[model samples]
Target: MHRLLLPIDALVTLFVLTAVWLGVSSSYDPALSYPVQLGVIVSGGVYLAVAHGLVTWRIAYVFGRLLLLASTAAAAVFILQFAYQDYVEVPAIIERIGSLTTLLPNLNLAWQHPNAEAAFMIGTIPLGVVLIVTSRRWLWRSLWIVCTLVCLYALLLTFSRGAMVGLGATLCIAGLVLSKKLIVRVGAVALLIGGIAAVALTSAGSAWVLSRWDLYRNSLYVAGDYVLTGIGLGDTFPLVYSRYGLLIQVPQLTYPHNLLLSVWMGQGLPGLVIFLLLIITFYLFVRRVLRSQPRRLFHAGWLGVTAILIHGLFDSRQYIEVLWLMGHLFALIGLTAACGRLALWQPEEDVPKVFRRYFPNRLVAATAIAAVIAVILFNQELLAAWHTNQGALAETHAELNPTLRAADREAGFRQAQSLYQQALAINPVWPNANRRMGNLYVKAEDFAQAVPLLEQAYRAEPANIATIKGLALAYMWNGQLEGAAEGFNLLPDPARMAEELLTWGYWRTNEQDQPLLGAYAYETSQLMLPGNVSIPVWQAAADAYRAAGELERARQWYERILAEAPDNTAARQALAELDDA
Candidate 1:
């Protein structure tokens, strides 16, 4: 590894850890993403460590080069499959494999989108194409030409309007840099003109232009909201985008379709700053090293980095909160640095060794060891959360069991009990741990055992919506309405508690042929429904008030319903019955 590696790795690792910490510390009271994020970050950190340990730059370079080459092969296969699907018979093997792919134009998959895929290819394809010119050996040069030609054939099919425009821009720049020849330059200019005119008049072009505008606008909104601290990692951006990004209405969106904006929204300003710093470091390191490295792989590594940067403008996959997906980019950086070291050191004569002299760097060594220790020792919240999740999953399985098999259900319950115990052991007073265990006890109809756990949960997180609602409901079901009252008193907005109680009430009234809890929820909601609420909701709310013997309250609700919905015969009949009373 290069001497500069420590800082590069440090920044990237810090950014990653920061992202995990954000998830751990997110407002998710149960810290829903905490355990998963911790696992991802730790595992990703391990991969990066191991990936960098491909200490022989030559070895790492070969590994990365093969993967990049494989992408070309993948594209070619996909293009062939597309052609076959269009016309006649495809080989069963190819036909079956093609079924997994979703993007239809035959492309590299950036979120299974051809435009995005084309953008990424536009970035990396240059590196692959450059190999033909740089390779001294005819055998290697021949391979490069074949791959590049296949890649271009696929790229042409894969591209949409915006990608077409981007490709034209890239060709123009490449032509200027690669040759001073007038013919090539003029051709590049002509291609740019044709490329721009080729797609702009089409409906697809106009649609994308509008879609991208809205996406960009919404993305900017998300970025602006969390400008300083960022949106905080995990499945955060999607939610933040939905709420803050009011500009576009989307079914589901992972990113803003722009890379720099993605970093800003996910990590906030500090993350973006650190990311930029890492890029700057890569640029400076490459500048110093590129002149000395005549090796094809070394240059390819630079081009690979270039591919991501340029493609990133249109769409991003590697910068997502999912660490494994994001970590590959960092691995590439390490490989690039390693390639530089190998090139400058006369690597042909040097004996290749994995992690050669690695442990000598105490910082890296300690980081590796300390990471493990810290996760186990310090992250009590994550540890507890993992156990709690296992318990929840077990409970879900028990509930989902269709056979009503006692042994299976009992076994699942026992498994959940043990997992919850482990979670409580990890953190004695962790609110979610206590609360979930209490919920399990409630499920078993052991309110006596549930009370303390629910109390502990309420005490630990006085304002947690889930904890409050869960605890209050447990109290109501346990026939200790005072306990419910106490928990509910803490929350200024008791609507969730009321809502949960009503949900339970529905099950009791309709399913269990019991009305007590249902009546309680209805009274708690004060027979209140917005005027615009559906008739079904009003009927449910009315049922509870009637069950509670609040006939006048029920009558008032019926009158309110009949006022707006005069044609509702059910409301009129109910009102007539109430008038007789």
Candidate 2:
């Protein structure tokens, strides 16, 4: 047990340390949020603690039984949820045409995304297999089979192409290895073929498969630039990919979808090596158990690991805590098989002399106390920021809701302001809190207060689109044209910037500020939307030029608009008016 644990502990520690190092080295302060960093550290600690507890108790059999039971219950819940969504929520969107495959929205199931849930379910399938194979009674085997089938059904409903492919591979391997009869192997092949056909025939499924190929290609483009160190954690992908990815719409991909690539991207080469080492070690352990026992549980573990590895090639699952726990659970069971029964408890006196002398219980207690303090220090600010954002959202709802009474709307605004103040009081440096508060002020047309708050937020997360947009609008409203232009120029999407600029120009025109309005329209003219040459844009440009006494430029734009739409009455009238001028 100690031998097995030593390697696992070393690997986990290395992974966690690498993650922390990546975070520290990141150029973007919010590249890895506090919650994610803390979660990773805590997950490693929890894994170690759980493994230690399991080994010390010597209840591997009991634990295995309990795990099977829990997995079965979870599978049941997943199936129920999937069924409800498919039958109940699905019909409401029947009129919408695209892919019938997408009619059932992917089940997130407590995870951040459906892919994560699929990973969890796919990882659990092997445990069910193990239980089924090991069961003595027919009833137990039948029940395990039912549970596994339910889990598989839910996995299918997730519409996760990676999981489906992984499932096919797993089934093939399991059939070849576990089945003595040729009929069983044939049955497995038939299932695989059927699964492939089902996915391929579905409208969305084919598109999903093609998209993954494209994603991989784009990911490679990003990998080329950051080949060695890779982009540091958090949401740097948006920034990096915008600069280096394929010339498509800047995708909102937060992470490299592939598990190995994600590790490489976040932690660089050393981290990737450590991750591969961990996988290799676990594989070897599972192999050893299979060689010795050749039982249902070992085979199931092997297949489960294989399925996750295959799925991970297409999507990220390695970072998810539940999957990590499952992996650790399998490793512990393997260790129990490798090392027979041993002493369940070890006394303090029996502990190594060096450990006792240097790392005593007092030191351990102090470390635990410091950890608690650190977590409190870290999470309080984040929680406060969340509350502040929630308040801002409530204020937005109040403003948008026409049914709300004037008094109620005023109260909502006050509550939002109080929340923002509370958030700032808790943590002045909390990103988004000040930005959101500034946005609230902008909504209220209080440019004076919005400016400084927005400036502060922009300083914290300069590349954040929301911050840039809010700050730009705030600057414009405050009559700071240069600052507004600077902020607007920083926007990556030319189309969006042009639209916003045109909107601002109309607002300025209403305010009788022709010069600023003209400047906005001129800026809009300089911006180009990909694959689109809009006549309305040209008309705005012509109107601005005419207002600014640039008659020749105005005539050219009017001509251009007329060329695009020969029957455009407004353009013809504008052109005639320009001719007279």
Tell me, by TM-score, which candidate is best: 2
lDDT of 1 at 32: 38
Off by over 4 Å in 1: 4-7, 27-61, 73-124, 134-146, 149-171, 178-203, 247-252, 290-293, 319-325, 342-581
Q: Return the TM-score for each candidate structure.
A: 0.48, 0.57
Where model 2 places Cα greater than 4 Å from the true spot, the runs are 4-9, 30-32, 46-58, 82-112, 177-205, 223-251, 317-534, 544-551, 562-581
Q: What are the lDDT scores of the predictions, listed in order?
A: 0.60, 0.62
Clashing residue pairs, backbone N/CA/C < 3 A, model 2: 31-234
lDDT of 2 by residue, 246-365 (tens): 222355566667878877776665677677776765554444344444434445545766887788888874454433443543444343432321222234434344223322346446
Q: Supply candidate 2's per-residue lDDT for 163.
A: 79
Error of 1 at 11 (Å): 3.3
Candidate 2 lDDT score relative to the true structure? 0.62
Residue 327 in candidate 1, Cα distance off native in Å: 3.9
